[model samples]
Target: MSLQIYDTKIGKKIPFTPLRDNHVRIYACGITAYDFCHLGHARSALVFDMIVSYLRHSGYKVTFVRNFTDIDDKIINRAQKQNTTCAELSQRFIDEFYIDMKALKITPPDYEPRATEHIPEIIDIIEKLMTKGIAYQADGDVYFEVEKFPQYGSLSGRNLDDLKAGARISINKIKKNPMDFALWKASKPGEPKWDSPWGEGRPGWHIECSAMSRKYLGDSFDIHGGGEDLVFPHHENELAQSEGASGKPFANHWIHHAFVTIRDEKMSKSLHNFLTIREVLKRHQPEALRMMVFATHYRHPLDFSESGLRDAQTSVNRLYNCMAACAALTDGTESSKAVATRAEIDKLRSLPDRFQEAMDNDFNTAQGLGCLFDAVKSINRISQALPAPPAQADINLLRRGGADVTKLAQIMGLLSQEPQAYLAGYQEKHLTAVGMDKAELNKLLEERIAARQNKEWGRADEIRDLLLAKNIELKDSQDGTAWYVAGDRGQ
Candidate 1:
């Protein structure tokens, strides 16, 4: 099936056809780079990352561009508070952003342009707007005249009258209309400054995206995306500036992911409820958080909570466990009866299509993950039923199924770690949570293995029961005895 994405501008799902055949250009608004990234940032990054991954997986040559607003008011304010330059502060946070993104296993964009690096491009766009009479300079500040652009609110679905009624423009007496947004702001004594036709000032938030996106993705791109919070004045004003200056549509598809909320309220610094990616990763595996993000539809609101994360962790652990079991069964000898039927092999091969189907329907990651979980269940079932010296054909089937599961999981950025490594990490986390010393538990397990080797069955059973009393369950396999927290069969 062809891809169909939900277009925020049209308020409906539309078939995704790139301007050029077999190639897609995407521009997603990146962070302001004033502080550490929060869960909201992580969601936005992962949503686009999945989109790009699926696009490439579907055979499209995708050029993804995500820009950073490194010279914003927030950066300046933060720099002042931290006793540093805006450049230094933004660079620090940008470095931290990369670290967090790497920890979450997010792929880097093809081009990560910084707003401060494109000063000339920003000035050029503002100059074009000025020449077209869509922008005016008042006391060294350049503002896009919202009344001049007929389609000013088209992208946001707000008419001029409605926008004016609810406008929250700065109280600068120099503006013509209350809704006129700044394309360039006059620099103060200590703020970042650039030489522009309008004067020494930096580009506004909206203009930076317009200028940078156009510079990389051209006058029009396949998709332009950001959070739902940007739908209002930010994107609305960006559309006005870019289209009004170029006399063309800015982007074919406008994709906006819904917000990440906490306790039914939007997660924000002002609410004092924002959770940073670093802090969350400190407590849970990065893939667990990614699972939590993907478990919901991209356009739906995701309420961040501890319970949600635990559930996601459990789900991820199940997939890893299934993978591990399949790996174990792959070593068994094959028998003719163990050779999967043609129909069975076909069904296993069709798993990728099922996963693609879910993803194609507007990047429905939740449904895609459901398909993956189904595969996990099937693989686990097959592994559990394997004979004691499994047939070579059945071993091949199990190996193929494991490979298929890993490949499909990669498309969604899950199950990247080695199965044994992931399981060991899960066990470690469980031990830490239960206040059990991992070294002590391992020493006891060693003692039990020694006792069993010496034919001391009673002593080995006593050691097992002692561990069981502490909520630990031990499973003995051909390799060795493994222990995990009780009731966590997935681990």
Candidate 2:
């Protein structure tokens, strides 16, 4: 199947061939940089990160740009509340955003333009709008004239008449029309200001993205993306400002990921239900959160819940266990003689193709993840059937299966850790979450081993019950005994 993208502009899935052959230029609207990133921000970042990964995996040379709005109303207000300069506050949060993105394993875009740094570019675009009669200056402020651009509402799928009907009467008397938005805001009491023709003022929110994206990705790029919440005024105004200024199409395709919600309500400060990325990271494995995000389709709402994260942890644990199992079977001490069938080898090798097929059809990561687990399930079943010290041919088959699953999983930034190391780290974290003393646990394990070795069955049973009561599950095998955190991790 040809790669397809669900373009929010045209409201349909289109066969996505780039504007230029063998190259894709993408620009995504980044955070405003006033606070720590939330789950919604993480989803947007990961969604585009997946897109970039898949495009490169498909042999497209990609140049991706994501811009930060460093000067906005929110930043000004937040700076005041924190008793700091807007630049200082924005920079601090941008640093925090990077830390969160790193923890989530998100790929950074090639160019990360800040609005304050691109003041000249912003002013140039605003001037272009003014020259084309698409913007007007009034009382030391500049506003985009929505009526000047006939295709104003096309990107957001809103007609002009309907928009005008639903539009509320703004209290601002300076704007020509109530629907018109600011291109440049006049300097406020203590907010950051820049010298522009409109007066000493900073660029407006929507204008910053248009200016920065053009500087990095040119007048027209292959793809533009953001959260769906940006579709209406933000992206719509950006579309109007860019196309109106340059008389060229701004971006060929537009993509928007849906929101992350809580109890069917969109995340907002008013509801107090949103979780920051670092906050969530403190309580759950970062990889587990990634799994949870990919479990749902990008355009579908993913409800935030503790149970959902626990389920994700279990799923991640299963995938890693599958890898660990393959490693053990493929250990070098196995029999060299070919004593097993090869029926499943070809099926195992076909996993990467299966995953790519899912990714090709509208970049369906949820479906792609399903393809990954399909291979894991087969490998697990085959491993269970094989004998101890399995034949070299069977071992070779397991190796191939493990290699195939790892190759595909990397595209989604999953299972990149060495199997044993990840499992061990998970155990350590689980140990900490349960408030179990590691040294004490080790002492108990040693004592239990001594009891088992001495055939003290009753004492061994008592120790086992004690550990199980604390949510530790024990398993006995030829290699000896091992334990796992059994129930709700509560982290």
Candidate 3:
């Protein structure tokens, strides 16, 4: 089957053909790194991550480059508050970002170039724009000449004349047109500055991405993605800057993920309604978070709520149990379930094909996941038969089906963790947060251990019930006993 994706540029779904044979180059706008990442950031990353994953699964060699805007105004402002250099503050968040990404199971991009590390590349692009008369300098600042780029509003489908009338203009003396955006801003006192032909100033927010993307992915790339909020000024300006400088199309496909809202309102720090990734992960399993993202299409708004997460958690738990049950059913048991027959296994093998069909239709993750849930439901029923220790063929069917879910989940950077480990961490974090004394809990657990060792199942069950009353959970794996407290709390 041929791969197809919805191209925002064409406003339609089309067969996906790589610029090069069996190769794909994708550029996703990364975080500014001024503070902790939020759910919105996670969504954008995961959305493109899925694109990259599916492309690879379809046999394309993908070069994924996600840049870091480490030299933005926000980083400088944050540095001032911390009484540190912008480089120091940006690096701190960059380091923290990877930690959160790991916890969320989001894969790192193939290339993560930082803006500060690529000043020369940014300056070269700006110089090219200047020589081309697409950009001009004024009072040590350089701004893109919107008039030179006649197609400036085409990507966004907005008329500049209308935008100028309705939009509030910035009070910058250097701007020749109300719509012309800055390519570079002159340095301020005590702020980070880089030497450029134009003057000692840093790259503007949008230019860094254009320069970095071009520097890594070349003049034109397969796909460019970011939050839908960036579709207007940010990505629109990027198209102008990169294409204007290179005289080539910026990206063949433009992908944008919709905003993550809280109670129908946008999640923003200014609005005081955003939940940091660290805070949210502190409460829920990362896979559950990823599932929440997968529940909605990339182009649709997702509203965050406790009930939604609860539903996601329940769904994840059920999936985990199904996978576990499949793992447990060994070769031919006394109670061989009819659902694990040769005919049934063959039916299960067709799931990946169905999953690919859903993904081929514009990366429809919701539909793809529905296929996954259907497979998981079927497997749960089959595993009950406990077929004489399931044969390699049977296990292979389960593995293939489970791997499909795992692969899709990973593409979205969700549910890629060992199910037991995630459950353990989820329980431990919640228990520890609820003001439980570990030493006291351990003493009670030790008593239960002695009873279980003496084959006193009743006493062990009784002791376990007492801990359950305190909202503590115990899981008995082959290794030993582990306990955790439970609650919906934030870090």
- Top TM-score hit: 2
Q: What is the C-alpha lDDT of each candidate?
A: 0.87, 0.87, 0.81
Error of 1 at 104 (Å): 1.1
lDDT digits (tens) for residues 251-283 of candidate 1: 999999999999989998889899999998987
lDDT of 3 at 341: 61
The TM-scores of all predictions, comma-separated, are 0.93, 0.95, 0.86
* Residue 460 lDDT (model 2): 89
What tens-digit string does per-residue lDDT give for candidate 2 at 1-491? 78988999988999989888899999999999998889999988988888899999999999999988999998999899989999999999999999999999888889999999999999999999999898999998999998889898999888878987887756678887788899998998777888998789998889999998898888998999899999988999999999999999999999999989999899866678889999889888888888998888898998999899999989988999999887766453454454334556666777878888889988888998898888887788778777656666677777888888887777778898999999998888878766898898988888998999999989989999998887888887768889987867554
Clashes of each: 6, 0, 11
The TM-score-based order of candidates, best leading, equals 2, 1, 3
Q: Give the TM-score of candidate 3.
A: 0.86
Residue 54 miss distance in model 1 (angstroms): 0.9
For model 1 the local lDDT of residue 322 reads 87
What is the C-alpha lDDT profile of model 3 across 1-491, one tens digit per residue? 67777766667778888897778999998898888888888888777777888888888899999988898878888899999999889999999999988887677789999998999998999999999999999898899999999998877788888898887876766588888888999998888898999779989889999988998889998988888888889999999999999999889888888899999999987898999898988767777887888889888899998778878977877777666565454544333334466656755777778888888888888988888788887676666654445555556567676776666556556556676666656666655665666687788788888888999999999989888766777888767797655343341
Error of 3 at 280 (Å): 0.9
